[model samples]
Target: MTRSTPTKPQANPGAKPRVIHPWPLRLTHWLNAVAVVMMIGSGWQIYDASPIFGFTFPPLITIGGWLGAAIAWHLAMMWLLVVNGLIYFLWSATTGHFRKIFPLSPRAFWHDLTAALTFNLKHEPGVYNAVQKLLYFGVLCAGVVIVLSGLAIWKPVQLWFLTDALGGFVIARYVHFFAMAAIAGFLFIHLLLVAMVPKVLPPMITGGRIEP
Candidate 1:
């Protein structure tokens, strides 16, 4: 039967595109995301008992019912965070990422600090500055503290040694709460900075390249 129908020309394929988020960053980001969500949910449950801001409403149920559930969720998420954070720390240390993030020179520190402040003031800040490094370091350290304090309070019977090491149950609880508050505060500032920059979120969310 007659001639074959003319076929449409196909475009030539090229090399695969590079993803923005490296495997390590993506894993850490997602694990942190899950952990933070669980932390917030359980935190609300725990807070229902005290009912700050003059609000006395329960979270999903009465204070006591949800509090135990919240603790369970919080503890589970804490394990995930601890494992993921440790992996990230080890990866960064072994690779050159740690050096890039934590510049040791005094001049570099001052330069980064100035750049960050200037950038905040509507001046051009080149990539991440010293303040950003410091913040990252602080968050990492805070995460460690949170995990230790959490263990001390959460498993006083099983981890009586840690509980005793950190003074007592009451002090451990207090430190855990403060660490949570610090992490929350950091989250607030992180969100604010992202909103202000808008450009920052795309890299983490879509694995897109961030243009300078």
Candidate 2:
């Protein structure tokens, strides 16, 4: 009788997951996630006081029971978010991570855009594409806008200049709302992209690449 041949395990094609996110990045990232979630919930509750839409958001999705509680929660989360974001940005700048994240050349952006549109998006090792650069930078800028607008709304009398530049208190409030919406949208898309490339997320948590 002929001896049966044993089957070999299939090899992983992509590069082994590595420590892409350093300790600082991972910590700040998770902290940011937590803060943002808290902010969203508390924000909804606060919005209930003067909802822009026809109806108020469901209580189930909101953080606090009343306006006062909501404001407290919102303020608390805001501080956490601000602190974590500052740390992240500072670390990235010091580590020269900005070069990988911020697209400076228009040619590179065009190439990346073409790749994305053609479903040929390339995931470089430890590098972000043009789309990612733009989106991330946009989110950061939006956060700044939200913070400024929130301050204006929260203390219109004290921060009169901000409110005035934003076309007064009501307009500032709307800007804050819109900025929050943009962040929410980005969060959704970010998760979707992660789902599409499951390998990318593990490094964020474990801080090491998974061996193929």
Highest lDDT: give the candidate number.
2
After superposition, the stretches of candidate 1 with alpha carbons farther than 4 Å from their true spots are: 1-20, 47-65, 104-127, 210-212
Best by TM-score: 2
> Number of clashes in every candidate structure?
0, 3
Q: What is the C-alpha lDDT profile of model 1 across 94-144, one tens digit per residue?
A: 866676556656676777667555664332222455556666777777888
Residues forming the 10-long window of minimal summed lDDT in candidate 2: 12-21
Tens-digit per-residue lDDT, 1-212, candidate 2? 99999999787786565567788988998998998888988999999999877888899999988999989999999999988889988998998877777655678778987987787987854578877787888889988999899999989999899899999998998899999999999899899778866778877888865355
Local distance difference test scores for all models: 0.70, 0.86
TM-score of 1: 0.73
Cα RMSD (Å) per model? 10.6, 7.2
